[model samples]
Target: MLNIAIAQLNYTVGDFTSNVAAIIGGMRTAFARAADIVVFSELAVCGYYPGDLLEDAAFLEQFEPALEKLLEASRQMPKLATVVGTVRRNTGAGKPLHNSLLVIQDGIIIAEYHKQLLPTYGIFDEYRHFEPGQQTACTLRIAGHHIGFLICEDGWNQPGRDYKINPFDALRRAGPELVISINASPSDIAKRTLRHSTLGKAAADTGLPILFVNQVGGQDQLVFDGASFALMPDRRIVFEAEQFSEDFQLIAFDEGNFTAAGGAALPIPSQGLSTEEFARRQIILGVQDYARRCGFSKAVVGSSGGIDSALTLALAVQALGAENVAAVTMPSGWSSEGSVSDSQTLCANLGIPLYVHPIASLVQQYGAGFKDAFAAPLQGLPLENLQARIRGTVLMEYSNSFGALLLTTGNKSEISVGYCTLYGDTNGGLGLIGDLYKTEVYALSRHINLQAGRELIPEAVISKAPSAELAPGQKDTDSLPPYEVLDEILKWHLEGRRMPQTEADAAYGFVQQLQAGDEGRQLVKRILGMVARNEYKRRQAPPLIRVRARAFGSGRQMPIAAKY
Candidate 1:
């Protein structure tokens, strides 16, 4: 049996040097296990979703030298055959760009393959940078078997496009003993079913064992959940890798036979927690990753007794724990009575320290100072934002004083359609729920409460009308459409179709035609246009946990200054 290892690794975008080190570290683990072949995710050396930097020779320059390092490292392990990824140069006298996977054995480059398919649609524009390779799949002779390899976009799709060659056809003709596919595929809720079915099809069609390896961890707005796996000749998952984290698994095969001797299935992250539990767990993972990567640990948040603060505090408590999480509650003239009490409830439940300071007098003091400068009545959006800004300022004061990461709790639905203050409520080192739509936030809250079989998010918190409460009587529905309608439109329009430039050409117009005449021509175009227009805010907003299929993450690249 030929033993194989799939390195499901976490990598940061633009951290070229560290990425190389990670690749070597993972390789060393595989060698210690005494595996015959060790494979890594596509583009693991340079991180996936490099965006337009691929067009810059300087970026590729930073990427190529790592290949030599891997080759050099291979010398240390004589028995291990390594397959790793890096950007490669195009052969002809054209702007050189090729997504590549290289196989090295005994300090020798045995075979190198370029990606055959270059995805140019939604969230991908590989055609803009990399030139597709027209070669058949390359095979490496390992452990008395001819094993084939393909890059991220190769051998995983069934397309009718002229640009990308069908590598599977060529590889099938070559009749390799095993076909290995490497990917930097993105993650989402729907991923589990889709990956299972699609990989099953690949295994069934090839009748040859197929190994699929993926990347893990967050990069900018994207989070890659590494659910790497191997499909046996029988079309069953013979080997499985962990999800949402980095791991290494070994699969042994003999000629056309397969065996999985290592790696265990990881339990899914506990998604349901009391309001205290849910917010804490998701936020902790979220805060821990973003803050730790960006270089911070302790964090502080505005701890108004409101649901948002309650939620953000829950997350911070989980992430930084009681000692590390600091909550500052600043109540202005309009701040409700039970707000502080609710905030205290959450902080007490989570065992975190709460700081209560009045902002009402401060606002009055500032208003008095600005009496001559500002004649407008203390109301409307301006007045509402003043309170938020004051609270934000206080949170910042605590954050700066203690060198703590600041967390924002605006949910996805609010961030979409612009319901938050730019430098006010939106200010923070990271936005934990920025990608989770409001409806999802409530659902997640409810799920946590139900699973815990007790009141975690406090019944009053969940049962109360959802409001920002910046004003005396402000509600979310007053400024926006029902969340149900907005979220549905978002999922379909944002991730389903391509964005068009103007109102007439916008995909939204097609949605109007849904029952007009044709069933097929959809309004998906309009939705994507909205997403494109909103890219500026997303770019400025701190990175968020990427749990959705097309979260505005590294995988979802949009041109900042593009026409249509």
Candidate 2:
């Protein structure tokens, strides 16, 4: 029997002091449990996806000392072997570094394995810095079991993925009794469930019991949920860790069976958090880690008393305490009374401070200045955009003076159709709800209020119609199709084959029905055109906390000057 401790920890990027301490702390915890081996997530030393930080000479130099510290720490528990993910220099050709996995016992480096698959698409640019490792498998004998190693992307090459090399197959052929796969998998809407189905299939086919560990926490726009688990050869997830938070636990493996460390049974859930709960948790962790990493404990939101900003403010208060969240309503001459009153009501419901900063005077000053300078009256769309820009400027001033991070409130529906002002509402340092469609935004608000068993977001804010308040009698429907119809069209066009099969089928069916009429067809075509034309605006917008599988940022990259 082999006792393995799986450490799913949140590591700060480039913070060698803290990361080294965390790795050592995990080792100590495993040693106290009398475990034979301890496994950590991929790139646990310096954190995953360090981006261009690896290019800096000084940054790369910091790893050697960190590795030495880990080796020194291992000497204290000679019977305990640890597998840690770190980076090593590639001496010969190609890129200069290799994403490496090291096995350390008694302060000695026993075995080493490099990640063979380097993903380059969709928020991954590993190929840009590290060389693809050679096709091989590394297995070590410990506690009467042969344990094979795989880095994050190594085990993901299943049958139809079209990758040239499959590391899991190689490890299986090597005849290891157990496999330890380390990952830094990010948490999206369906990612956790997808991981279970895909990896469970691999385990069943290979006929090997597998132990998976993942890093947790947020790094910029990405959030890693640490739902590490052990899969039996029969495709049953016997033991699992927590999600969206750090967890360390011990599991016993004997004769291809897994149990708790003390030989007790383990209960694994058949399903994880629901879609709405998953989105809520992902956004909360993303926002919390992003604000903490960027050196801000407080956040400010430009509340519009509409669903988007209301949801944004509600989420902010959940992440940072109500005392740490501030709301400001900048209503203009065209704004409705609900804009101010609803914002105040929502803030009061959440127990956060609310400030009213009317932007009608600022809008007039900007319009007059434009007319005097260009000898032309600023009217029509330009005037509306000017009002948005003025509000954006006021938000920036408040942010600079108050030392609080601004949270943008644009939803994916508005962001997709280019209905948002780039320099205005988009002036925040980070966005809380940009990935959620307008419909999802409303769903989340209601979910929050329901979960709280009270009106945390105020019913008036959620029930009111959405508008920019930039023009008289302005409503979102005045220019765009109803959200019910428009959301389906955007989902079909933007998500396409990436969405779940059932959802894709429904969206496709709805879009096909809409094509029966000329007006509906033209509306879909116009929305698609707006999405493509707004690439430049999205390219410059602040980073948004990603909750969906395909977000607007690096997950769905597009060219600014492309035709298709």
Candidate 3:
């Protein structure tokens, strides 16, 4: 019988000691089970996106000891063949490092494989660091079965675009009986089915069982969902590992049939859940891990009646629970009755305590103090910004007083174009929804209620127009295009990586409106200008849970001063 284990874990970038320790623990468990092999996610030791830190000499110095420690630990598990992802260095005249999966056995480095497909477009820049691998894949004999291996990005292939040659083809050339893949492939609603089909097809065509392993949890804007699995030679799923979690799985293959044997078989945390529902789980875990990793127990947020704050509060309540969450309702004069009602309703629904503190009195007091400057009518963005700043001040004050981390809740759509007040609405310990768009936020809310078969967020809240409510008769659409229209353009520009002209003419007829006249240009200018300018704000915002493969934080690095 052939035994395999998957280590789906939440690994922080540059946290070498912790990552190494986790690998050791996993190896021990895999050995105790008498498994011949244990697999981990790509770049598991250094987190997925270490960015340019792999180039830093000082960090490399700090990384060396972890490798020795890991190797020493692997020696203790001589019976287990371990294939774990990590940065492997080459101290030669060139070739700085490789994003490699190290194969260790019998107290020696059995083999190593560098990723051949160095994704250069969108959020990846693997091409910038390590050199692409050139060696043909080989089979490893373990437990009397020949096992093949492939790294993340090795299996993904899109038609039309030139894709790197398949490494698994070369690996399968040796006629292996089983294939093991390690991945840090990030989460995407569209990509999930493709992942399963791809691995299953590989297993069926090659007549081998494929065990797929992936990373989990949120680091910056990228969330790695760990729906690790095993595909039988007949292309049927025999095992589905947990998703959006740190987990382990065990599978056995004998007599040309595979069965899930042990290692905590749980329903994938996110399957068929709407993007937001999945994202909510991802963000809650993101916040929970971020707070725990940074050494904090509780979190606090300002709960306005707005969708952003409501969703943020829901996530906090779910993540840290009602006992550890505190919501402060700081309302200004422009705040509507519905807004206050929604906030209170959501607090009760989530079972969290709410503190109602009217900011009108504070605003009035500030007005009295600045009577000279406030003698004239308060107008434009400055006045609108002041109210937001006031709320930020109160939330931070509470954070300091209670030692609770503050979670900022700005959606990707808002953060993309400077719809947020920099130090005001942007002030917090982390931006929970900073990677998600406005439309995505609503979808996620609906998914959550649907999943629970009850309304956690009110039906009116979902149906109502979104607003900051800092000004009378305020609505997001009053300043920006409708979310449907805006999200379409954003998906084209951001995800499709295309300019306006590149989009289908009918799908993007708004270009004509944008170029029609001064008013058009001005509105487009406002939207585009905010998007371009807000890079700085996103750069400073606290780390958020990344539900997508590409989010605004570390996964995507744009020049704050660049003109798009």
Candidate 4:
């Protein structure tokens, strides 16, 4: 019988001290548990996707010392073999380094396996810094069992479609008793299901029990949902770690079956969180980690009393706590009475302080200055944008004065069509709902209230018509289609085939039906044109927590100058 511990940890990028400390902590726990082996997630040393930090000579210099530290720790727990992911210098052709995994036992590095597949699409660009390893399986014999290893992407090509060389096949040929796959996989709506299906199929087809371990935490726009699990060839997922948090578990493998550490049969994990609940947890973690990493203890959101701002405030309060979150209502002359009242109710429900900074005087001052300087009355579109800009400026001033990170409230629909003023609602350190559609914004707002068993976001705010309140009687529908229609178009156009298969088919069919009529076709064309023209705005917008497969940031790279 072989006992293995899964260390699902959260590592900050470039923080070698904390990362090593966490890894050693896991090792110590595994040692106490009397486990023979402990497996950590990919890049547990310097964190996953270090980007350009891998290019720094000083950054690269820290790895050897970190490994030595791990080696030293391993010497204390001589019986436990520690498997960790880090980087190593490459001597052969191609990149300067390779994404490597090391197996250490009794202060000796017994086995080293370089990652063979380098993923370059979507949010991953591993090929930029690390060279791929040779197409050979890395297997080691320990505790009377043979184990094969794989990095994140190596196990993804089970269908033999993504990459030419199937690492699973090669590992199968080598004939190991089990396979251990380490990953830093990011979370999305259907991503957990995808991982289960893909890896489960691989395990079932190869008849190899696979242990998949992953990291959890918010990294910039990416959120890695740990949800680590062990799969059997016939049983699929038998065990799963917690999602969106750090977890450590020990399992025993004996006679080709995995069980609890005490040799009892492991119960199958639950079906996991719903899509709305998943997004809430993901965004909360994103806000928490982003604020902490950026050196801000508090977050401030401009409260418009609309669904977007209300939801942002609620999520922010949950993430950073009510004491660490503040809401500011910058109502203008055109602002509705419900705006301030709803904001008050929302903040009161959320247990956060609300500050009202009336922006009517500020708008008048800006309009007067513009008329005097430009010799034209600041009315029409410029005047409307001026109110948003003044609110944005006031929010920024509050952020600076109070040392709070400003949270932008623009959702995906307005952002996609360029309905937002660049320097106005777009001005924030981080966007909380930028990846969510306006409809999704409402859905999540309702979800929050339901989860809280009360109106945390205020029912009045959720029921109100979507508006910027920049001009008298202004509604978002005046500038764009209703969110119900607009979100479908944006999804079909922007995400396309990248969406989940069912969602993609629904979006495609909805768009095809719209194209069946001339007015609908014209509407589709106009929305597409708006999206194309809004590239410049999105390019300048703040980075949002990515909950979708194809977000507006690095995932969707569109040229601003070139016509599509």
Candidate 5:
């Protein structure tokens, strides 16, 4: 039997001092638990997805000291073996570095394993920085058992797939008693289920008990949920860690079975959190981590009392606390009474202060100035956009003076169709609900109210029609389709390929039915055209917390000034 500790941790990218400190601290905790070995998530030393920082010589120079620190710490706990991820100089003709795992015991490096599968699709661009390591199964003997190692993407190459190499196949042939896989996998709608299915099948096929560790917390647009788990040879998950948060656990592995710390049988949940719960946890962690990492403790949101802004404020308060989150209603001449009153009610309910900053005067000045400078009246669509820009500027002033991070309130539906104003309503340091479709925003709002067991986000706010409130009697339906229809259309156009099979099939059927009619077909064409034309606006928008399978920022790449 081998006693093992899984450290599912959060790491700051390129902050080696904190990263090393965390690793050392975890090692001490593992030793105290009387475990033979402790495993950390992928790239825990420097955090995951460091992007081009891997090419910097100065950045890479600090890694040796960090590694030395880990090595030195391992000497104190001579009986404890530590498996950690770090970048190592490749010293070959191809890439400059390799993503590697180092095993240390008794202050000596026992074995080194390099990642074989470097994913380059979607948000991953591993091929740009690190070269693939030579194909091999690395096994180490510890406590009368042989253990194998695999990095994040290394174990993903299942047999009968198109990939030329399967590391699991090689590792299984090498006959290890167990396999340990470390990952920095990001969270999405179906990510946890996908990981469970993939790893569960691998364990069943190889007849090897598997321990998986993952990193948690938000780094820019990506949030990694730490749903780390251990699987038996029969594909049964015996032990699991907390989801969307940092978790640490020690387990015993013997006879292809996993037990809790001190050899007690582990009780595991058969199903994970509901979809709404998963998204809620993911966004909250994303907001909290992003704020802390970017050196802000407080957040400021331009609240229009619409669903998007209401949900954004609620989430910000949930992550940063009501005292740390403030909402400002920058109302204009066209702003409705409920826009301000509902915002006031919502903020009061949550115990947060609300600031009423009317933008009517500012809008008048901008209109007059535009007429003077451009020799034409800034009326019609430009005039309405001017109101949004004035409000955005006011919010920016608050953010700058108060040193609070600005949270943009645009939902995925508006963002997709270019219904938002760039340099206006789209201005922020980060977007709280930008990844959620309009319908999902409403659903999350209701979910939040249900979770709170009351109308924390005022009933008026939830029932009100969503609008920019920049023009007289403006309604979203006046410019775009109803949210129910628009969200479906956007889902089909933007995330069709990545959507769930049932959803994708449904979206396909809906689009086909729409194409049968001229008006519906033209509506689809116009929405697609809007999406294509708005790439530049999205390119300039702040990083949105990704909660879906395909989000705007890095997940989807499109050319702004090109025709499809």
Candidate 6:
């Protein structure tokens, strides 16, 4: 029997020291567990998707020393083989490097395989950095068992895919007893289910038991859910790891069957989290890691007593404890009384301190100065924008004074329709819910309350009509359609084919029904135009935690200067 250790770890990009140390630590733990081999996720060395860091000579220079250190560490545990994902210099006529996997034992490299497929679409641009590996299968023998190897995207090409090559076919031809695939797959809505369906089918078709390992952590706009698992040809997921966190486990493989480390039956995997719970955990991890990496221990948000800000504050508190999160309510002349009172109640319920910073004076000064300088009254859209800008500036001042990261509170709907001021409400280091639609924002907020079993977010905040509160008695509906209507339209326009089949079909049908009527067609045209015109604002906005298949930052790329 061969004992295989699955190491699902969290890695920080460009932090070679911490990453290598983590690898060595996992190796020692696996050795202690008497495992024959330990498997780590893809790009474990310098972290996954290092982007332009791959081009830096100095950054590339660190890999050699790090590898040497791993080699030296391997010498100490010669009996245990280690499988690691990293980068290597490609001595061929292509890109300067290749995404590589290495198997090391006793201070020597035993086997190596470069990743075959490099995805270029939807937040992945592997082709821009490294050359693809040759279309071939790699396998190795250890402890009397034959094991085939695959990088992340290699295993994605099933029988009927459009790719030129199928690595699984080559692996099948190699006729290994088992297969091990390493991945750095990022998490999205329903992504876990998709992984299971796709990989399970691939496993059954190949008639090979497979071990899939993945990494977990937040990397800027991306968050990886490490729901690693072992799949059998019988279409069963026998072993699975935790999601949204680091996990390690050992499984014994004998005669193409997997069991617990000590030859016991594996426990069945749970059904997994709901969509809302998944988003909450994902955003929490995103905020935690983003703040920890960016050197901010505390976070602050401008509390408008609306669902958006309330939810942002609640999520920030969950990520960094309530003591670490602060709320500043900048009430203007047009602000409702419930704005401050509701914010106080929300923060009080959350156990976080609330600071009331009235922005009415700041708005007056800005409006007066603008009128005097420009020789015209600042009374229309500019006046409303001045209020948002004043609030933004006050929040920034608080952030600067307290060394807290300001969290932006615009949802995807408002952002899509250019309902936000560029540098005003968008002035923040990171966004927690910018990828979620206005309707989704409410759904998640209600989920939070239900999960807490109390009114953690005041019901007044959730039930109140959505508004910017910049102008007197202004509601969001005054400018745009209701969230129920606008969200579906934005989903069809922004996500389209990228959304899951159920959502895509629903959104498409809703849009088609709207297009059938002249007024609805005009509204759709206007909404589309608003989304197209606001590319500049989104381009300047802070990076948000991505929960959907197609988020704004890297997933959806559109040229601002071009006409549609």
Clashes of each: 10, 0, 3, 0, 0, 0
Model 4: worst 10 consecutive residues (lDDT sum): 263-272
What is the clash count of model 6? 0
- Write one digit per residue (lDDT tens) for candidate 3, span 1-564: 878777888898888888988988999999988888888888877788888887898877866687778778888887788898888775554467877878888667788877777787666788888877765784688889887777877766423144657776676678877778888877765456667777767666667777788888766556677888877768677677777778887777766666665533433323455555667777877787778777878888898877888888877878888899988988889988977788889888888888988888887777666766758655567778989989998999999999999888888888787788878888988888877778888878787788768888888788889888878898998878998767655654455532223333533566565557897567666667667777887787777766655567656778977777
Clashes of 4: 0
Consecutive 10-residue window with the lowest summed lDDT within model 3? 497-506
Roughly what TM-score does model 6 have, to 2 decimal places? 0.99
lDDT of 5 by residue, 124-201 (tens): 999899989888999999998899999988877775474688889889889998999989999899888778778888
On a 0 to 100 scale, what is the lDDT of residue 502 in model 2?
A: 82
Q: Which candidate is the best by lDDT?
A: 6
Over 455-478, each residue of candidate 6 has an lDDT whose tens digit, in order, gives 999999999998899888999999
lDDT of the structure predicted as candidate 5: 0.89
Those runs of model 1 whose alpha carbons end farther than 4 Å from true positions after fitting are: 52-65, 159-164, 262-286, 449-456, 496-539, 553-564
**Tens-digit per-residue lDDT, 531-557, candidate 1:** 567667767776676555566645577
Stretches off by above 4 angstroms in model 6 are none
- Which residue runs does candidate 2 get wrong by more than 4 Å? none
Q: What is the alpha-carbon RMSD of candidate 5 to the true structure?
A: 1.3
Model 3 error, position 306 (Å): 2.2
Rate residue 151 of model 3 by lDDT. 83
Which pairs clash in the backbone of model 6? none
- For lDDT, candidate 3 versus 5, the one ahead is 5
Report each candidate's C-alpha RMSD, comma-separated, in the order given. 5.7, 1.2, 4.3, 1.0, 1.3, 1.0
Residue 123 in candidate 2 has what lDDT?
Answer: 82
- Report lDDT (CA) for all predictions: 0.71, 0.89, 0.77, 0.92, 0.89, 0.93
